[model samples]
Target: MITVKAPGKLYIAGEYAVVESGFPAIIVALDQFVTATISPSDTFGSIVSKQYQENSIFWRRQGDEMVFDNRDNPFHYILSAISLTENYARETGQALGVYHLGINSELDSADGKKYGLGSSAAVTVATVKALCQFYHLPMDKSKLFKLAAIAHLSVQGNGSLGDIAASVYGGWIAYHSFDRQWLHLQRQQHSLTELLAMDWPDLKIELLTPPADLRLIIGWTGSPASTSHLVDKVAMVKAKQRGEYQTFLQDSKACLKRMVQGFRNGDLATIQTELRQNRQLLQGLGDFSHVTIETPILKKMIQIAETAGAAAKTSGAGGGDCGIVLIDRAIDSTQLLKQWAHEGIQRLNLNVHTVNDDVISKA
Candidate 1:
């Protein structure tokens, strides 16, 4: 048996703007993960999840609004990973074999509620990693990330693949999305193996090291947000307000640039300052788009964190899920956490998972 795990991720600064080609976001890999375990099957191959009682036929709409039923599917992401990896394997002159794959996730609450910790991204990366081991394929970090990103985008079809980068590379990373338009154009002409080796324009992933005095605090709002839904809402509304959307993208790009520099220079104060700016930017964005980027509970959570002398903001596409706080190590967070507890907020016990840490650990 072979088991592999990929860590979940949170967007520390850039959120809505990261979806644009070449736009940047700062994301960190969290301790929670999705694990994929695979073993050879002599008779029939199957995909299963510990969260589901049975493996059922899966279906979803495609570009032309056509629905297709696939029996091998247990989940969209896991199925995408399996299909793409096998395609890649065949493109590389490798024969296929049957296997049974099982998935388990830690990116959710005990009751099976999502934490919005990029569960799909983690699972896709984990599935790809596990299959690589099963096939005796050698892949470096970059290659693995490219493969996982492709698989994820095939299913989700939106957003920046920064979560995929965070899962593959681990730890703090400054990610700029590649040009999906260019990718779409190339897909018509290139094989899976060819696409993996090609240069993806504007795609950048830089690992960052946090200052020693910087402290990151995460608070869960007990509500899950659909990132795709939020992104779609913004897109629909932003069409009518192109000028403001453009400015938001430029400002976000510059803010994340400074935050990345802060990490490089060990400047905790600048990092916090930029974080506050990012929060305000996101709020303005939410206001303009009329989408609840920060729900009432998340807003309350941020207000408390800021009162505690920390810079706070909604972590991902907002609506709900988790908020992140950046504070100096010298500040006392006791009162802040106490107040959060009074409001039913749960502080998550999560830390950065570095690339040196295990992206795929054997069990």
Candidate 2:
């Protein structure tokens, strides 16, 4: 049996600006992720999922055209991965058969089907890695990353592809986009992994779970706002006036340079400043926050978070699924968490992790 686990990611900086400015964006592999286990089987190809119970067991034959069981289809991405697997096997002349594959995700926490933190990407990476291992496909990291990217794009239609890259590559990533193409650049002048593994500085972070008393308020805009669509729109929006856009681009580039330096220097204050400024620039692009996070409820929540002295921003796709809030040192995160609960906004205490340190036990 072969197993693979991949991490989720959070974009700390360069959200919308990364599109227009082609600026470098920083991301961290979160502790949350999806796990896949594949076992060789001759009886039949079976699939089980913890997330979907009833439809978990699917029996099929070798080279049989796999059909998705809509009764418990998590998302179209799963089907895309399956199709890719078949195509890859046929193209590479590998024997195609039913491998008893079990797929599931162990997230830090989730509010049902909330669309934040790259769950789809996690599944895609896990599936791709599992298949690669099962077939013993000698693909390099770049090739594996491309396969994952293709599967992700099949579903999202448009995404930065940074999430998949970070999950597969397992490290802090600097992402860029050009001519409608996404680029994942290597910029680990410093690695949190090497630092943590070596136990250089005992990085101390207080990951506080929001008190159970508070309800995290999440809303779906019911609008399918494509990340690429929003990003491309920003490009078109900024093109009408070159000067302002160029200035924003230059500021973003400078901000990214400083942000990287801050990470290396362990200067949280500078990082926070850059992130705050990046958020402002994203807002200027007008496609920064997703609809759900932009609603009055979310606006009030951010205002409340600020009033309670917390650093907050929309997580993931922003038109909104989740928000990450950092409480002030002097403030009790739990106390503020309770207050937000009183206001009907949900809070989550999540742990941060570095690539190749937390998950990615094996490729």
Candidate 3:
């Protein structure tokens, strides 16, 4: 049996802006992970996830695709990974054997709510890693990232793939968006295997080492946010109002640049200022797009974090999910956490996952 794990990710800055080509976003991989265990199966292949559903899903390859017994499938990301990897092996003159897979995730709430910690991307990466390891395929972080991105984009249609990259590499990273327009057009003409063999030099990825003095606090908003819906809302607004959208993009790009510089130089003041400005810009985007990017709970949490001398803002697509708080080591987080709990926010105990270390461990 082979087991693989991949960490979830949080966006530090450049949320909506990274959807376009050439814009950069900062994301950090969290210690919490989605784990996949793969072992040989004689009769048939099955995917078991008690957290996601009541029963296991039985699947088999029918011709060139994986077919599930039931129509309502919750393991879409895993299926995509398996199908793509199988095709990749075949295209590269290799063969694969069937396996029984069990997936378990630590990225969900106690009561089963998703933490919006890029669970889909994590699972896809983990599945790909496990399958490749099972087959002894030569896979590195870069190749793994590309495979995961292809699977995720196949399932979600549109994404920056920042989360996918973070899961594969595992650490603080500054990632430029891929040319989704080109990828989408190519997908219509070629298969997944053909796409994987092609080189994409336009995508830029850089590793960042944050200062040791930097402190991070994550607070969950209890409600799960739909990134797809929020992204669609923004896309609609961009289509209707090109000038306003361009302005938002420009400001976001500037903010991201400053934040990246702050991380590189360990400038706390610059980081704080950019975070506040970025929050306001996100709120403005919410207003222009007619989507509630910042909820009342998130606003209250930010206010409380700032009152405690920490810079706070909503992470990812907002609406709900988690908010990030940056602080120095001098400030006590006891009162802040108490106030957040009083306001019904759950403080998540998480740390950054680094690429130099092994993110996956055998059971």
Q: Which one wins on TM-score?
A: 1
Tens-place lDDT per residue, model 2, 248-363, is: 77887788787777666656566666666766665554532222325454555666666765555554546655555544355656655666677666654445555442322233
Candidates by TM-score, descending order: 1, 3, 2
Flag regions of model 3 displaced more than 4 Å. 54-74, 188-194, 357-363
Candidate 2 structure lDDT? 0.58
lDDT on C-alpha atoms for all candidate structures? 0.88, 0.58, 0.85
**Each model's TM-score, in the order given?**
0.93, 0.69, 0.91
Candidate 1 lDDT, 144-195, residue by residue in tens: 8888888888877788999999999998999999999898899889997788
Task: Give the per-residue lDDT of model 3 (tens digit) for 250-318.
Answer: 999999899889989978878888988999998888888888988999999999999999999999999
lDDT value, residue 26 of candidate 1: 95
Give the clashing pairs for model 1: none
Candidate 1 Cα misplacement greater than 4 A, ranges: 53-74, 357-363
The total number of steric clashes, by the backbone 3 Å criterion, in model 3 comes to: 0
> So what's the TM-score on candidate 2?
0.69
Could you give me the TM-score of model 3 versus the true structure? Answer: 0.91
Residue 188 lDDT in model 1? 89
Q: How accurate is candidate 1 locally (lDDT)?
A: 0.88
